[model samples]
Target: MQVSSWRKAAITASFLTLAASTANAAAGPLDPTQGGAGGRIIRVTTLAKDGPGSLKEAVEAKGPRVVVFEVGGNIDLGRDVLTIAEPYLTIAGQTAPSPGITIIRGGIDLKGHDVILSHIRVMTGADGKPHFSDWEADAFSSVAAHHVLVEHCSFLWALDENMSASGPRFTGKTLAEWRANTSHDVVFRDNLAAEGLAFSSHPKGEHSKGSLIHDNATNITFYRNVFAHNVERSPLVKGGAQVLMVNNLIYDPGHRAVHYNLMNLEWTGHPYVTGEITAVGNVMRGGNSTDADLPFLTIGGDGDLKYYGQDNRAVDRFGKALPMFGRYGETKARILQQKAPLRSVTGIPVLPSGEVETSVLQTAGARPWDRAPDDIRVLFFVAEGRGEIIDDEHQVGNGYPKAAETRASFNPAAWNLDTMTPRSGRYPGDQTGPQEKLSPRDAAMRQGGV
Candidate 1:
């Protein structure tokens, strides 16, 4: 059936609403007596012009509420809407929400203290050019604001039409500086961040920073987040702050995954001296156009960098290993200690077909095998090329005499090679010359010596 984009979107929203309602019902009715004044959930969908006040006003009316910005339809943060203030409130997105509330011509000033913002997209004006407003000094001029939570949101540049030639380039500087000093107790997780500039412009530049648990911000946990197609640098940890970065997929089309540096405390007027950064189980891939000289990750000055179970797919522009700081043992230990067992949060059933089976059986004396458990494995016999088992238990080896010999000796009958077959190999069950001669033990099995 052909479904229009709008219809598809509507269907998705309906499904989400139904799922949420069912979940709430399963949890039972909320007790008004619990958790101080029972957390309130406020929905914001009306346009600011249609209504007199901004979405912030709606949240304030609820009194210590959880304001969910239900962006069912398109809405804009016009020039007049300048600031938002709400204490102990959560600004969440609904129904394909894109940064529910955006600060356009005039930057947004966040005054609400200890605010939790999630699933909301934050972007600049639509103008193609940079609107160089002092975001730190003017836009977000909150004095007492702290403990901000930003998750599952997309932070990017404004549209081209909203930009002007005279405006400042949509460089990542303003935001980077803002995070360096202003925000505290900030957690950014499962969010995508991309710098607007090109690689040539700021080859070694740094972008946003904060309290990342598993990724960028300090005291923040970033798990299963994708950071890809980023220009310039990713997160630059300044000063001596500890950040836990794990299980994140960080790829830079232009630069490295992360850069750690010792803050020139004297020059930058910062108090901290070194950054203690730990990274684990992260997949770091580089862009094709990137210079071969750079490493997938880098650390500067006298800072610590530790990595464990990390996979670096792309070599940096330089031939040297990605610059990582810290002791390897300590980093691995931290990752092991912090690792949590996977749990089913949604109560989804596991499908039998979805699970993959991997097991290997080898003859008595064979070359030591080096293979990951997850990799596919195949059993090959030279006389048959490859054989098939009739059932889970290899009661029947249907191919050549070598196949019968293998099944008899290897008891289990099934063997996983954990190796990719060459394209030129003969078809399964067809006898062919061995690409590489097998070990004496393997040769005996092929000759039916088992």
Candidate 2:
């Protein structure tokens, strides 16, 4: 089901140019109406998976609600993925005390619009299950959902894609309608997606995908994130998918790193709408477990891909350079060159590729001031050239931390309801900088700061 390659066309109209000083400028390009603005604050008071005062309860509550954490600890979902269908929601994990909320043995299925999630950790670990035995899930997912901005979160130990944006590719009658129906206006920034479990519960035998921007999903942005220890997808863009990938640090890729593929079979009777990826100032460094000679971006399938790549760095284990692009599957499928990205998305904070590694280590992931052990290991491994793509979470350090659940009251007046940012610019229950209480592991990592 392969379609012949097409010639490059003129660049489309711009999306939106974002300014940080604007009344509503989120981390990503989407401006105004960040999430759950002026909505009821739903407090999570329990570490239980679903009962009253639980995260699932807060997520499932009807109408627009802002979810804040009263308890800080791990919420075990018993290997089940919690589905989120409510709209206009904001999950403010940063409101928790000390070590913030972490969801273990489960994942988040975000199917809501106008949502924002920040400072949350999700570890969909292999729960001691046999190799390739049972079901698998991603640490976070947004399918057919729009107006999302997921910031400063950590997604780890997933048997599938760590974080993904996807939906029915052929949902509407026309291509424009279809693209609108799929996931759009979504942003993933300042996050860590690492160690997506390879060869574990995924029936696919080897599935450690960083993320997948599925076909027809448009207006997606991945900014200043760390994609570490994942085999591939880091992430893959499919047909008609338009993405702005900027200032991201990709460490220890198994086979691929930013790729675009439009499966002809998936497009069957539908037209082969080309995918576009604007990659700017990203760094890709191979690690111990990386596949040899893996390129930074690869093209496959049958549909032509429109690409605009600038200032991206790709290097092998010893700092030797690697090819920036490759072709596979349908080799004849051409890559259409673009001079610039669409104008729709504007406020691109593209750092110099050389500085991406440092920036990500310092700021990426949930609660960088208090990184989870696994996240600490992942960041250090990226820095020190250690760590590998593993099949199980237990192979590394303690699979999940067991912190005593602590309660705290969230004062909504102290936060900007739109962005969930504290009015005082300082988070609650935090000492000054890296000088605060540091665990031995954290102390060692933060010689200056992690």
C-alpha local distance difference test of each model? 0.33, 0.80
Cα lDDT tens digits, model 2, 1-450, are 211011000001111121121122344334424677677889999999988999899989987888888789899999899998888877888788868999998998888898888889999988887776776888999989998888889999888889999888888799888988889888887789999889887877888999999899988888878999999999999988989888888999998888889887787888788788888889999998888888999999989888888898899989999999898884557888888765333545455787667656766788765667677778877888989888888788767778777787888787677666566655655443332334888788878665
Clashes (backbone N, CA, C under 3 Å), per candidate, total: 39, 5
- What's each prediction's TM-score? 0.48, 0.89
In model 2, which range of ten residues has the least summed lDDT?
A: 4-13
- lDDT value for candidate 1? 0.33
Best by the TM-score measure: 2
Worst 10 residues of 1 by lDDT: 356-365
Give the Å error, residue 101, model 2: 0.3
Clashing pairs in 2: 14-343, 14-344, 15-343, 15-344, 16-344
Q: Which parts of model 1 are misplaced by more than 4 Å? A: 1-37, 49-53, 59-62, 69-71, 78-85, 95-112, 125-145, 158-182, 198-218, 265-272, 301-450
The TM-score between candidate 2 and the true structure equals: 0.89
